[model samples]
Target chain A: MKIAVDAMGGDFAPRAIVEGVLLAASELPSDAQIVLIGREDSIREIFKEHNFESSVVEVVHAEEVIEMGEHPTKALSQKPNSSIGVGFKLLKEKAIDIFCSAGNTGAMHVGALFSIKAIEGILRPAIAGYVPQLDGSIAIMLDIGANADCKPEVLAQFGEIGSLYAQYTFQIERPRVALMNIGEEEQKGSLVAQATYPHLKANKRIHFIGNIEGKDLFTNKADVIVTDGFTGNILFKLGESLYEITKQRGIQDDFIDKTNYESIGGSPIIGVNGNVMIAHGISSPTAIKNMIGWAYKQVQANAYLHIAQALA
Target chain B: MKIAVDAMGGDFAPRAIVEGVLLAASELPSDAQIVLIGREDSIREIFKEHNFESSVVEVVHAEEVIEMGEHPTKALSQKPNSSIGVGFKLLKEKAIDIFCSAGNTGAMHVGALFSIKAIEGILRPAIAGYVPQLDGSIAIMLDIGANADCKPEVLAQFGEIGSLYAQYTFQIERPRVALMNIGEEEQKGSLVAQATYPHLKANKRIHFIGNIEGKDLFTNKADVIVTDGFTGNILFKLGESLYEITKQRGIQDDFIDKTNYESIGGSPIIGVNGNVMIAHGISSPTAIKNMIGWAYKQVQANAYLHIAQALA
Candidate 1:
């Protein structure tokens, strides 16, 4: 299996990306190959600094670069030779099994939506965030920053998508899926939430556990929580900042440690036609290594196939 | 000023509520009066336990009690003799300047909407929450759980309401108002966010600062942040639970101390005819005391009058 990585993306590009790819390559299966997609000369220079064998990794040159601040759709279209633009091309042609980037989030999202496109019959692809539960377990929350305004049917579809990711990614059996609402009672929540309740209840694809409030975000209430992008994104960033606040205050604890975004490196853009992964822009070498490892696990598990069959 | 206390409300009803009232009474101005609305017998018993002066506190008989679990609208209407019911009646009659309860949130909300009603010309009454900034200053956020689905006009009105409260209460001069969206760019965010952007920008009544994202929530970006109730409620509860999570981990820090709900006690329900406050259901005696104190400040500031004039 071959994996294509955007070496020109992220704050610590080329250098950190090269080292992380080397680390992942050394530990990966013997048959697995790494294709570094970026400016060829810069990537080769970093690899030579460590004196690593050039035969183990392949270099695919990308002439243009997409700055983090550029508009995603415009940047992708304007720079076909950009690392992100070329990476998507490799993934589409089946030259690589996975395409991972730690660069611009909006760029990655747009690339996923228009390039490979969402899975057949899917309304919109969702981005899932890792939630550290109090009980030492982790839960998956989806649509964190995509589909900000969602209909009831879209929320119902997200339930199946979130459940599939949880089962294959975390190996949770029949993952208990819950909709994030203001109250646990079915009658409670906004009009959108109220309309989505019945659809989630009747959704036979996943174990529907009804509504879960914001207070239950880090609890053992449910393994998969589905929400629209607007609320989910706010909750996601709030939790992330809370972790930062606790850290800044010199509060040392194990659970608080899990809140660190570095530990989970990146999140998978599930429901997409092909394997696509997004890492934080500030990812370090260790984070990039973990992101590659996570992508490898997804490929091995055939998670995309499971989701397609579930939706089908 | 006369304040009506729901002595029968809160998790520690009668006992904690009565004790908190006594604390507020002693520290309040010489002209202040405390009217305890609950079971006449139980309230007198709590006052007797403290050997407090009966002359400073008055008890109004309320035979029925609204359970925390009961439906909000149904319980408020069905139980007219309930403490919450009697408190609202006194507020409506102008017999009391303020009414506060920590018993049930929904009940407090329903009672406020039905009894005193919203100030005329106000699109919707917005309930604001306090956010503890990293700089030790506090920011007021509006529509936390009310008006889950808001049109562009409602959001504009909320900006003015929040600005007035911040001016009179916190004494912020020309408080900077900002719209909460997915991105800081003017064109960023969902359709509703897009629509609300121009309205907030054109709202000459407020000092609009365009948009702020999830990352700027606790930062010093804006003093008054406006968003629809659905997203605000989720972020509010998520922030509240973060305080709980840090506390459970036993992480002692001054910043985390601000996250404690007890410090603020209750959040004043803005855009209403009369002053009203609601505390957490599990509020202790200390939280209750703080709730009463906050209500007193709002009454002193004539916050309601300022809001009405601003809208006019």
Candidate 2:
């Protein structure tokens, strides 16, 4: 199996991406293969500078690069040879097992929907983020800013997707799922929440816990918290900002330390036909390395196969 | 002006409420009056225990009490003699300039809607929370769980109400208003955010800034952030949790310290016919005292009257 990295995707592309891929390449299993898709001349030059010229990693040269601000759909078609575009092409052609990019979020999302498409019978493929718990364990939340407006059926299906993630990715058996709402009662919150409560409770794929409030975010009460992308995105960014504050103030705690994005690697676009991870735009070399490492793990787990089967 | 206190409300009722009133009473203008509404016997007994028997405080006996978990509309009607009910009665009768309680949030919202009603032409009354900014100043965000569903017109009106609040309460002139969204672009986010953008931009009452994402929560991007109650409530509680993390870690930054809910007193229920502040459920005496203090400032600013005239 081959894992592809979009070396031209992030803010610190080429340098950070190349170094990160090399770092991941060193730590990965000897049988695992790495495919670097981007401008070949630059990546080769960097590999030579790092004195790893004989590295076994394969390089796939792409003629163009997508800017961080480019429109996802337009750029994907207009710049077919762009690293992100080429990476998607390789994944669709079965040349790469998974693709990872720290580039344009919209482009990654567009690629998941248009390039490879979602799993069959899936209403929508949502993005997932890692939420740190007070205990050593971390909970995974889904639909984080992908498909901002969700109907009752869509949110309920998130329960299924999130459950599969818990079982396969986090290795939590029979993950407990809860709806993110303003109040703990099933009847509280928005119309969408009130409408979605019964559907989630009736879902047989996962254990549905009652509603979880904001205070319950870092608690061990629930293994999976589900919500529409709008609310999920707000909570996701708020959590990110808190992590920034902790680091900025030079505060240290075991639980707080676990919320750092770099440590978690990246967020996955689940339910897509092929497995993919999108890193932060400003990610460091360590973060890129971690992203690659996690991508390899997901490939081993075959997250896409389980998701497609479950949805089917 | 008479300020009414619900002595039977909140987790630490009677004792905390009475103490907070006295703390405010001591510093209030000589002409300002405070009426403690609850079971008069218990309040006087606590006053005696605290050696404040000689204090010139007014007490209005209330025959019933509403527990924190009781349904809002049902509790308000069933217990007319409850502290919250009587407090609203006093306000409607023009006997109290303001009323405050760290009681059931839903009860307060119901009372605001039914007891006194909203200002004329108001679509719905919204509750506002004070968001601390990085520059030591704070912005006001509205519709934080009051009305779960809002039309575009209602949100546009919130920009106006929030602007008036910023100018009169926070003392910022012509406050910059913004719509909270999943993305910073005009075309991004949920349907509500997309629909509300044009309304806010066209509304003549506010200085409408464009979309603001989650990362700008603590920034100086906009002075008043407008969002549906569902999104706002999640962010509100998330902020509370972040502050809790800071306290637990013993992080000591001036800005981070300000995020403490206790220091900010309470959130105000805006767009109502009278001034009402709702403190945290487990508020300390200090938080209660600060709530009363801020209520006094709002009274001086005549926030409700200004909101009424602006809406008219």
Candidate 3:
């Protein structure tokens, strides 16, 4: 299996990506191949500085780096030879089994959708994240800003996708799926949520846990939580901010680990045709290393195949 | 001035309410009076336990109590002699300067709307809470689940209400008011937010700080944040859950201190005809005491008068 890494992306760019690739190369099985995409000279210099051999690590030179502020689709279109673009092209051509980037998330999502394409029946692909709950369990929140406007059927699809991801990723059997709403009552939410509740309740494929409030998010009410991209994105960001604020307030807990960027490493752009992992723009070297490892694990676990089969 | 207290409300009920009223009475000027509305037996038992004087606190016998599980409007109609109902009656008859409760929030909101009614020009009254940000500043977030289905005009009203509250409570001169949206761009948001943006921007009475994302909420990007009740309620509850999760995780900071129920006490229901303070149902003795003080401040400040002037 081969994996392509966008070495020029993220805050800790070339250095972190370089170190991560080397670390993965050392620990990965001999059958696994690694390719780093970035500027030729910088990649070479870093490779030499790390005293890494050229045999296990390969570099694909690219001239441009997509800025976080750039228009995602426009930048990807304009910069065809950019690290992100080239990396996705490699995955498209089957040159690599998977591609990973720690760069502009919007650009990553756009590039993944256009390059890899969505699954046959999927209306819209989603991004999922784990929010640590008080009971030492993780809540899997999906569509964390992938598609802003969603239909009731689309939300039901999210419930299926999110529940499967939680079952596979967190190893939870029969993951409980809850629709994020303002209140637990059937008549409590926006028009979309109200319409979606009945469908989720009737869906026999997944364990529908009914409506869960935002306050109950951290209380471990459900293993899998589903919502539209708009609300999901806001909730995801709000949860992230709250975690940071709490840590800043000197609240120390094991759940508030510094390994957030490192352990989770990156978010897999699920429902896409191929394996694609997008890391945070501000990820560190350790995080980058973990992302590469995560990509490899996903490939080994046949995540895409499972998702495709589940949807099928 | 006379304030009616729902002595048989909340987890601690008459005991905590009696203690809180006594503490508040001792701190206030000699002319201030309190009416503790509950069953005479329970009120007298609490008063006897505390060895409280009858001159400062008056007990109004109420035959019924509104249970947490009961429907607000239905319960009010069914049990007119309930403590909450009697308290509302006092406020309606202009016999009490203010009515405070730490009971069922929905019931309180329902009773307040039915009893006190919205102030003259107000289309819909909103619930506002102070969220402590990372910068040690509080952002007044409003319409946190009062009118879930709201219009742009309702959001603009929320902004106005929140702006006025921040100016008076936090004493910020010309507080910056921001509309919460997916992005800072003018074009990014639901139909309601997009329509409300231009009106808020044009309103000379408001500071109009533009659109802010969920990530910017805890950073104190704006002093007054407004949104439809649906989004506002989700955000408010998310903030609360974060505070709880972080506190449980042991993240200690001054911001966490501010988030404590004891410090923030109860939230003032804005746009109402009379002062109505709503404490958390799980409030402690300290929270009840602080709520009493907050109620006193609101009454003295003539919060309703200022709100009327601002909206006039």
Candidate 4:
């Protein structure tokens, strides 16, 4: 199995990316190979700086780079030789089992849709975030920033798709799926949520646990938390901010520590045809290293295949 | 100034309500008075338990009690003699400078609309929550749980009214107003947010600071945080939960401590003709006591009159 990473992504670029890949290479399974896609010379220089040499690492040269501010469609089309473009090409051709990047988020999202594409029955592919629960577990929250505006049907399907991902990937049997809402009552919420509740309830695909409030976010209330990207993104980012806000005040707690974006490193774009993860633009070497760990688990879970099969 | 309170409200009801009033009576100004509306006997019994007697505390008989789960409109009309019903009646007749309760939130919101009505030219009355900023100051967030669904115009108006309220009530001149969105860019966020952006920006009534993300929530980025009720309620509750979640783990921080619901006690109904506050249903004595402090400040600020004059 091969895991492809974009070396010319993120703020730190080739240095942080290559250093992270090297960190992952030390613990790599014999069957797994790390594929670094970017300027070959730049990656080699970073590898040499750390005196790291590994047979498990391979570099594929790409001439162009996609900056963080570049428009997704425009950049991908104009720079087919960019690292993101090349990484997607490898994943599409079955050369890599998974593709991970901390680069232009829009570019990575657009590249995935343009390359492997969404699963046949998927209405929309969502970006799923990992929320650190108080019980030392993680809950999968979908549509973190993908579909900002979601119809009732789209939201209900998020419940179905998110449940399947959690059940297969996280190995939670009949994973409890809950709608992110203001009130726990079925009738309470925005018009979309009110309309979506019935659809989720009628659907036999997921174990609908009714609505969960904002206070229930880290309470280990549900395995799969579903909402439109707007609410989900704000809530997820607020949860992530706990770490930095508390740390700046010289305060520390075990649960708040997990709220750090570095702990998870990346968020997966679910409902797509294959494994694709997008990390923070400010991702450090440690964040990249942790993202690689998740990438390996995602490859092993192969939940996309399960999602496709279930829909079929 | 006559400050009326519903003693037959909240989970603890007359006991906590009477006790909290007793606690506030000690600090009550010579010219200010607390009018407790509920079963007079029940209230006096609790006051006796505390060995408290004060000229500042007065009780009005309210024969009926509205349960927490009762329908707002229906309960108000049917239970005309309920504590909440009597409190609103007093507010409507200008018998009290302000009315406060920890009863059913729906009931309080509906009662405000039915009695004092919304301020002229106001699109809607929103529940404004006090968000504790990391800087030790408080920012006012609007539409916490009033209207579940709000049009773009309603959201933009929240920014204007919130700004006015913060300026006059919090005594901040030219308070920075911001829209709560998924991204800082004006073009980003859900369809409603995208449409609402231009309205807030164009409104000359406010000092618009553009979009603020969830991470900017406690960072004191804006004095007035504007959002639709659905998103605002979820985010506010999530912020409030930080207190309990950390408290259970034996993790304590002064900043996190302020996130406690008891710190400020109650959320005020903004854009209404009168000053009205709705506290948490499970409000304790300390919470009620703190809420009274805010109620006193709200009356002194007289922000409603300012908003009414501005809209006129």
Best by TM-score: 4
Candidate with the larger TM-score of 1 and 2: 2
DockQ of 2: 0.68
Where model 3 places Cα greater than 4 Å from the true spot, the runs are A19-31, A135-137, A246-251, A258-263, B22-31, B242-253
Model 3 pairs in collision: A249-B252, A249-B253, A250-B252, A251-B250, A251-B251, A251-B252, A252-B250, A252-B251
- What is the Cα-based TM-score of model 4? 0.99
Best by DockQ: 4
Per residue, candidate 4 scores C-alpha lDDT tens digits across A99-135 of: 9999999999999999999999899999999998889
| Local lDDT at B45 for model 1 | 83
Rank ordering of all candidates by DockQ, starting from the highest: 4, 2, 1, 3
Return the number of clashes found in candidate 4: 0
- Model 2: docking quality category: medium
User: Which pairs clash inside model 1?
Assistant: none
Worst-scoring 10-residue span by lDDT in model 2 chain B? B48-57
- TM-score of the second chain, each candidate in turn, equals 0.94, 0.96, 0.91, 0.99
Error of 4 at A15 (Å): 1.7
Clashing pairs in 4: none
Residue A109 alpha-carbon offset, candidate 1, angstroms: 2.6
Q: Candidate 4 on B1-312: residue-level lDDT in tens?
A: 998999999999988888888888888777789999999899988888888887899999999999999999999999999999999999999999999999999999999999999999999999999999999888999899998889999999999889888988899989999999998988999999999999999998889999999999999999999999999999999999999998998878898899999989999999999999999999999999999999999999999999999999
RMSD (Å) per prediction: 2.1, 2.0, 2.7, 0.9
CA-lDDT, candidates in order: 0.85, 0.85, 0.81, 0.93
Ranking by lDDT: 4, 2, 1, 3
- B1-312: candidate 3 lDDT, tens digit per residue: 887789888988877777777777777666678888999998887777878766878888999999877888899999999999999999999999889998878888989899988888898998887777777777877877777767888888888877877787677889899988877888777777788898898888989989988887778899988876777778777777655666665555667667676676788888988888888787777787778777776777766778888767
